[model samples]
Target: MPLNIVLLDDEQHVIDLLSAYCESIDAADIVGRFSNPIQALNFINNHPVDLLISDINMPQVSGIELAQSLTRDVKVIFITAHSDYAVAAFELDVIDYIVKPVLLPRFLKAISKAQNAISASEPSTKELGNRELSNREQSARYIFVKDGGVKKRLVFDEILFLHAQGDYTEIRLKDKKLLLLGTLSSFQQLLPEGEFVRIHRSYIVNKSNVDSVDKDHLNIDGQDITIGKTYRQNIDEIF
Candidate 1:
């Protein structure tokens, strides 16, 4: 299922950058982008979004306030420039708290948590919406892939990352890349949470495969991928 998303922030640059990054993630679609909180609230009244990505500091209303007012099962990921508000963000039971200059990789970390959380149970306002990895159990250990008209079965752990093209996802393994037709999200949902994270909108890197991360990028087996500003916190928490 595609996650319908709404993004609200006062900054146009932040909104545009994040909107593009969200589109790249291929996990969901940004149905609306509102610079005005009141307008955003009004839009919400008429439309139900599966996810919300909002800025904590706003003139008329705070992200926390909007979160409290939300009546739907939608999970929220708060984007803030200040680190001081991280505790407060979490206190509101936000799925994830991200510091400003959001990176796409970090954003996916939040999305993963939210997806896992919503998948576990029916979402409600009062329940903590954050995705937790402690309760996860291993399911499939291997995946069967078709390459050159031949079926190939490989262990899930053998995958290093999956890179997305226009209409296909290149599954990167330890030794080779397999071309498969589908959205990156389809493979993302199939992968185990603890082992993998979408480091870029187009790339899902294995946490174990990651060698290191710099200020603007992540290093995985000598490959560097830019991280979006909004996703930094969750990335820091995990990696």
Candidate 2:
């Protein structure tokens, strides 16, 4: 299911940019975009939202205050130019605190963090105590992939990297590899942003599996992957 998202920013351009970014991610659905904090608050109260992307400094009501007024279950990601609010943003337990001007890659990373947080909060079948289910049960940690005639479930944490094939994507795990009929861009939208990064045009590496990184390349579990020039700036910010 795509996550319902709400974007709030006083600046029209910021709102437009964020809305466009959200639209690019297949997992996110921007249900509301508002320049006024009060209108955003009202919309959120009336609609169901899985994530909230908001600017820190606004007119009448601040983003921090707006977040405080929300229910505990709502996840928030703060985007702002000032660094002084970092401590306060974290105090509210926001999913991420991004300093502007926000780059596409960095924004993607923050969105991924929010997705993971929301996934973690969802109740699993096991948690609900349903014992009649089959042994092959699906959970937030795994995704179902069809390989040839068989359907396989791949765990998110077990994945090491994903490389783009002609029109398909090859997912590399610690023990095996799976090929799916999809593009790198599609995978980019589906996968959590915080855990995976597009080091190259054809490759997305799991940040947790990354062992080390240098100027031009990054090592992931003994395998070396070249970092693309265009992504260097974002990669630098990450490491």
Best by lDDT: 2
- Model 1 lowest lDDT segment of ten: 128-137
Error of 2 at 179 (Å): 45
lDDT of 1 by residue, 88-122 (tens): 78887889999988888998898888878777876
How does each model score on TM-score? 0.51, 0.52
- How accurate locally is residue 1 in candidate 2, as Cα lDDT from 0 to 100? 74
Query: Model 1, stretches more than 4 Å misplaced?
Result: 123-239
Which 10 residues in a row give candidate 2 its minimum summed lDDT?
A: 130-139
What's the alpha carbon RMSD for model 2? 14.1
Clashes of 1: 12
